[model samples]
Target: DVKVTQSSRYLVKRTGEKVFLECVQDMDHENMFWYRQDPGLGLRLIYFSYDVKMKEKGDIPEGYSVSREKKERFSLILESASTNQTSMYLCASTLPAGLAGAETQYFGPGTRLLVL
Candidate 1:
């Protein structure tokens, strides 16, 4: 099965603190992405990597960054967690050929994060 696993199912943090969220996919897919989902805003991309050691900023990359040292793993780092950063974080991966950058993506269950 194609599975993406996140380091946390839930997280609580204080303002101005650094946070790290790790994700790993067992399928060895070439592309991985990090996104944040809010109540009414839908899913917003934070960062994405198409290959190892390569990264790109997404729509909402202001307070976040990403890393992909290995093909199967990616990490999202919150430089300083803030109240506005509190949301459901999702990690996803897709095959390179068909849907890597297409309209569809396979997502993790998600991590609910709250910043105080």
Candidate 2:
């Protein structure tokens, strides 16, 4: 079975603190993504990696960065926490598009971050 895991389900951080949100997938998928959803703003893609050690910046990569040191693991880092940055962060993995199997993504439970 395919499983995606995040380091934390919920996180509370003070302003200016560095925060790390980690994600891992059991399947050896080629693509991993990080996204943040805010009220009214909807889902915004932050970053993604198509291959191991290869990373790409997504729609909003201003305050967020990512790492894919291993095939199963991807880490999202918050340079400095802020109230404006508080949102539900999500991680997902998918098979390469247009493959034999479904290209639908399997997502982690998500990390809800609150900056105080």
Candidate 3:
């Protein structure tokens, strides 16, 4: 089974503090993603890495950054935590396109961050 694990289930940080959320997958998936979800706005991608050392900014990448130094681990960085940055962050991984079940994404439980 492909298992995705997150470093934390909840986090609290003061404004201007730096935070990091880590994610790891047991499977060797080529695509990994970070997303933040809100009540009405739904899920918004923050950043994603398609391959080791390759990354792309997502729609709402202004306050977040990502690192994928290894095939199984991906990390999301919050440079300066703010009240508005508090949300449920999700990490996902999937097989590359053209493979069976490639469209299916395996997601971590998520990290709920609260910036006070």
Candidate 4:
């Protein structure tokens, strides 16, 4: 079974501060994603990584960056936190596409970040 965990369940940051969101998967999934959930906007993908040291920009990649230094871990970095960037951040992991049930994503508990 795949299990995803986030480094924090809740975070409070000030404007212009750097925020780091960490995610880990236990199943060694090859694909990892970072998403931001906001009311009425649904989930917007921030970044995704398919392999170590390789990352792709998603729907809303502005002001955010990602790193995949290991097979089981992925990190999302907010260069300078802003009030508009405050949202519930979710991390998910899944197997590579084309396999059975490869679309199924295991999600973390989410980190609610409040930027002041």
Candidate 5:
């Protein structure tokens, strides 16, 4: 089965601290994504990479960035963790181009962050 794993299932950080959230997929999928889920707001994309070394900013990429040095791994970086950044972050991957479907994504369990 296609699986995506996140670096942490839970994280606690102080305000202004830089945080790194890592994700790895074993399915060799070409598309990887990062999103933050807040209560009632649903999932908001942070960044996504379509190909190795290529990345694109998503809807809510304001205080975040991403890196994709390898095809199976994608990393999300929080420049400065703020209280407002406290949310459940999800890492997901999908089949290569031309394969995305309504049920395309394979998501990690999620990493919940608490920024104090």
Candidate 6:
């Protein structure tokens, strides 16, 4: 079975604190992504990695960064947390695109971050 897990289910942080959101997948997928979900803005991708140590910025990369040192883990880093950055952060993993089941992403439970 494919499983994705996040480091925390809910987190509270003050403004200007560095936040690290961790995600791990058991499937050994080749692609990993970090996204933030908001009420109206929907799911906006922050970053993605297709291979180890190779990351690509997504639509909303500002104030966000990602690290993929191993095949099973992906980390999303928020340099400095802010009120505007508070949201439900999600981590997902999937097979490389163009392959079977590539469109189906296994997602973590998500970490809801609140910046005070």
Tens-digit lDDT string for candidate 1 (15-99): 9999999999998788899999999999999999999999999999998988898999999999999999999999999877554
Best by lDDT: 4
Tell me the tens digit of each residue's lDDT in model 2 across 1-116. 89999999999999999999999999999999999999898889999999989999999999888889999999999999889999999999998988477588999999999999
Q: How high is the lDDT of residue 33 in model 4?
A: 98
Task: Give stretches of model 4 more than 4 Å off.
Answer: 99-102
Which residues of candidate 3, in runs, are more than 4 Å off? 99-102
Q: Measured by TM-score, how close is model 1 to the native structure?
A: 0.93
The lowest-lDDT stretch of 10 consecutive residues in candidate 2 is 95-104
Name the regions of candidate 1 deviating beyond 4 angstroms.
99-104
User: How many steric clashes does model 2 contain?
Assistant: 0
lDDT of 3 at 87: 97
How good is model 2 by TM-score? 0.94
Worst 10 residues of 3 by lDDT: 95-104
* Per-prediction TM-score to the true structure, in the order listed: 0.93, 0.94, 0.95, 0.96, 0.94, 0.95
- Assess the local accuracy of residue 17 in candidate 2 as a C-alpha lDDT between 0 and 100: 98
The CA lDDT of each predicted structure is: 0.92, 0.93, 0.94, 0.95, 0.93, 0.94
The clash count of every prediction, one per candidate, is 0, 0, 0, 0, 0, 0
Candidate 5 overall Cα lDDT vs. reference? 0.93
The Cα RMSD in angstroms, rounded to one decimal, for candidate 1 relative to the true structure is: 1.9
Q: Could you tell me how far off, in angstroms, the CA of residue 113 lies in candidate 2 after the best superposition?
A: 0.4
Provide the lowest-lDDT 10-residue window in model 5.
95-104
Off by over 4 Å in 2: 99-102
lDDT of 4 by residue, 5-90 (tens): 99999999999999999999999899999999999999999999999999999999999999999999999999999999989999
